[model samples]
Target: MSKEWFPLIDEDKCIGCLACYNKCEHGVYDVENGRPVVVYREGCIDGCHGCGNLCPEGAIIYSGEYKEHIKCSCGCSD
Candidate 1:
């Protein structure tokens, strides 16, 4: 199974720059009404935050890394 991960866009922070849409090579985002939207959540690769890291407005939020806790087998946090 693929790891649970997706990008969340902050509408207020997004400037419609299309930076995130242009940076994503996995077809994870789409431009709708001049705004970015996650059209293919499953297309996003696990542990990949390229879109979020490339957002010029810092509007993209990646939840992949945090979700790793659910599958972690190492008892490092205890």
Candidate 2:
């Protein structure tokens, strides 16, 4: 399997602070489950520049290729 380039957010760790959205100007982040989720995925493989780093609880992650680094509630990281 090949790796798909994209960044993702951990919704569970997200406190609905919209930090990724507010932090990025690419509109790559959006509100999901009251937290910020990766909406626009394009040329965002390396991650949202600093979206994951801004996360307080380290919910955001850059998983392996072909996998989604963004995670949702229930401790699931795609």
Candidate 3:
């Protein structure tokens, strides 16, 4: 579990596919109203973005000091 690492889901981009929920091995997500929610944020691993990588809509993003470890597809990187 990590204090800084967690998933942020973009509701607009999310299609309620539950891909992130299904990809996560940890109890980090919960299905609510046919969508996924970050229920156990602290359960996220320090350098893991497995769920985000599996999202077809690219709805998931990670917030933490480990941002540099991931390649930003949206060109947000500087």
Question: What residue pairs are clashing in model 3?
Answer: none
**Candidate 1: segments with Cα more than 4 A from true spot:** 1-3, 64-78
lDDT of 3 by residue, 1-78 (tens): 347878899999999999888877778999999999999987776667688777999999888765444443322232
TM-score of 3: 0.79
The candidate with the higher TM-score, 2 or 3, is 3
Can you give the lDDT of residue 42 in candidate 2?
Answer: 60
Residue 39, model 2: lDDT of: 70
lDDT preference between candidates 2 and 3, better one: 3
Tell me how far the alpha carbon of residue 47 in candidate 3 is from the true structure, in angstroms, after superposition: 1.1
Q: CA lDDT of each candidate?
A: 0.74, 0.59, 0.79
Ranking of predictions according to lDDT? 3, 1, 2
- How accurate locally is residue 64 in candidate 2, as Cα lDDT from 0 to 100? 50
Best by lDDT: 3
Give Cα distance to truth, residue 49, candidate 3, Å.
1.1
Candidate topping TM-score: 3
Q: Which sections of candidate 2 miss by over 4 Å? A: 1-3, 43-48, 64-78
